[model samples]
Target: MPHFKLNYFDIRGFGEPSRMIFHYAGQDFEDRRWAREQWPEIKPKLVGGKFTGKFTASDTGASPWLEVDGERIYQSVAIARYLGNLFCLAGKDGMENAQIDAMIDSYKDYLNDARAFFWVKSGMGQGNLEELKTKFDEASKRFFTFLQKRIEKVGSGFIASKISWGDFFLADGIKTTMNFDEEFEKKFPKMVEYKNFIFSQPKIKEYIEKRPESVF
Candidate 1:
């Protein structure tokens, strides 16, 4: 058995990347998910003195944590990076690693902006749909355009030369954006191609085909 345990809600959200990483690496780990209704009973036990004595984070309330080798690893990005390094999915060299970092940073910025827009427009009462749409349009165009150019330059189906964590990040971003607006592909053809290409990868395709689909 692997010495790793992943704890998160029964959704993709932040835990999806780590789950994908483990799957791609063929690593055996425990995937522990809590249902929404069961959270009341489970939360206290997971966070109480019993479990908390063995696992603790700076913020004990945070979910999507990784417990490995009897050590608690907090923060989603940190967990992803650690797994990436362990599985040799980061890059081959320092410069290549830097490229991965740049790509992940850009992707994170796009996600943050898109998520903000989503939260603001969800209520619809005090939100400005037009303004939020405009903001999303601009951010999406710039980020996807840059990604398209990078993929073209790399001449690989992935963001980096070889498969890396950033590729999954990019794929998830494209999937989320396309989910939000069906017309997203019409707006960005290159991004659409990129998304399809990433999905076509043997491991990724297999992962998607078998993984459970749930709303985050």
Candidate 2:
């Protein structure tokens, strides 16, 4: 196995899915998080290096990047898909994989919508607290309903019948979103169950417990 090097900030943003993927796959990798202040020095090298690239940060360029086996890989989704394929985490066959992809897409859309409303618009006067609450309430309800149905259909207690990249994606999404409030969890009991189920996985639990708590 190549030494998987994940580079990002300490926050559980982009690199988290990759970390969970590798952990669920029982793969060993290094999680490297840089402080915001350190980016000035590091950004230049990343831009000037062989895999020169830039991503948007605050409307400019700040992308989550990764380097696998000494080669650079940009974009969080691409990294997740690549790792999923490499580790047989995409599911069993073509149809199954496509289903996994659809689920991933759906989850991404949910996150994007939430980001836009909560992080971008809520406090900017573009929308008020009621508006934000309404948006989140609707989105979360829809997500919870869909996930509950999916789990029932699959009958496996997972988004996919077998473990796939979507599982990790959902796990991370559940963990992050649940930070909002108890009401969110109450409104989405299935999701809460799903999240707990993923966390209970031996490997995932080990990773969470053993992971360093220091802000990187």
Cα lDDT, model 2, residue 167: 82
* Residue 159 accuracy (lDDT) in model 2: 71
Clashing pairs in 2: 55-61, 55-62, 56-62, 57-62
Counting clashing residue pairs in each candidate, in order, gives 0, 4
| Model 1 pairs whose backbones collide | none
Looking at model 1, which ten-residue stretch has the lowest summed lDDT? 50-59
CA lDDT of each candidate? 0.77, 0.72
- Cα lDDT of model 1 by residue, 129-161, tens digit: 778778888888888888888888888777778
lDDT (10s digit) by residue, model 2, range 7-116: 77776777788888888888877777776666664554343444332322212245466677677788787888899899987777888778777877877777766664
Error (Å) of candidate 1 at residue 41 is: 6.7
Error of 2 at 69 (Å): 2.5
